[model samples]
Target: MGIIKLTNIRVYAYHGCLVEEGKIGSDYRVDVSVTANLQPSATSDHLKDTVDYVLVNQIVKEEMAIRSKLLEQVCKRIIKRIFNEIDIAEEASVEVSKINPPIGGNVEMVTIAMTLHRSDYSDPTQL
Candidate 1:
């Protein structure tokens, strides 16, 4: 098994509970990692045999563009999409960070993370 990671995907999106946050928007950083059997692609030297990083990036960008009230929700959606879309991926995780958030204290960002396995979804059809 091997892991493919897409790190520090920068996006500007409107995702927050505050009314101003929805209107003004904020910068966000997203990271996604997936574990899959890489031996096939490694030996075949073909893109089709491996987890496509391009598709992963596109998923992140598309999901981030949608509005959400919390980072946790964003993380869930990201992980769900990864597992559902990438059939080769056995497991996946996502981290979403809200840069320069509106929280009352000094903080670089507030992040929420979630990990999911293909088996975690009771229904195979859902995966």
Candidate 2:
């Protein structure tokens, strides 16, 4: 097993509970970690044998494009997509940060994180 990490993906998006937040949007940073079997890729050195980081980034970008009321929901969506679409992924962790949150006080950001294993995820097709 091996861990693949993609960190500090910056995006400007509109995701918040407040009305103004959605109109103005904010900067966000996303981090993703995936655990999978890497022996095949490690030896064969083929992109097809392992999780593709570029595809992961595209997924993140696509998810971020959708507006949501909460960071927790966004984080979950990313985790679920990675686990379901990436066949080699055994586990996935996602972190989302809203930079310079509008909390009335001096705050740099607010973040939400979630982790899930492939076995723990419900089959989407059954739903």
- Residue-level lDDT tens digits of model 1 in 1-127: 9999999999999999999999999999999899999999999999999999999999999999999998888887777787777889899989999999999989999988888888777764563
- Give the TM-score of each candidate: 0.94, 0.95
Pairs of colliding residues, candidate 2: none
Error of 2 at 65 (Å): 0.6
Q: What stretches of model 1 exceed 4 Å from their correct place? A: 124-127
Which 10-residue span in candidate 2 carries the lowest summed lDDT? 118-127
Q: What is residue 81's positional error in candidate 2, in angstroms? A: 1.1
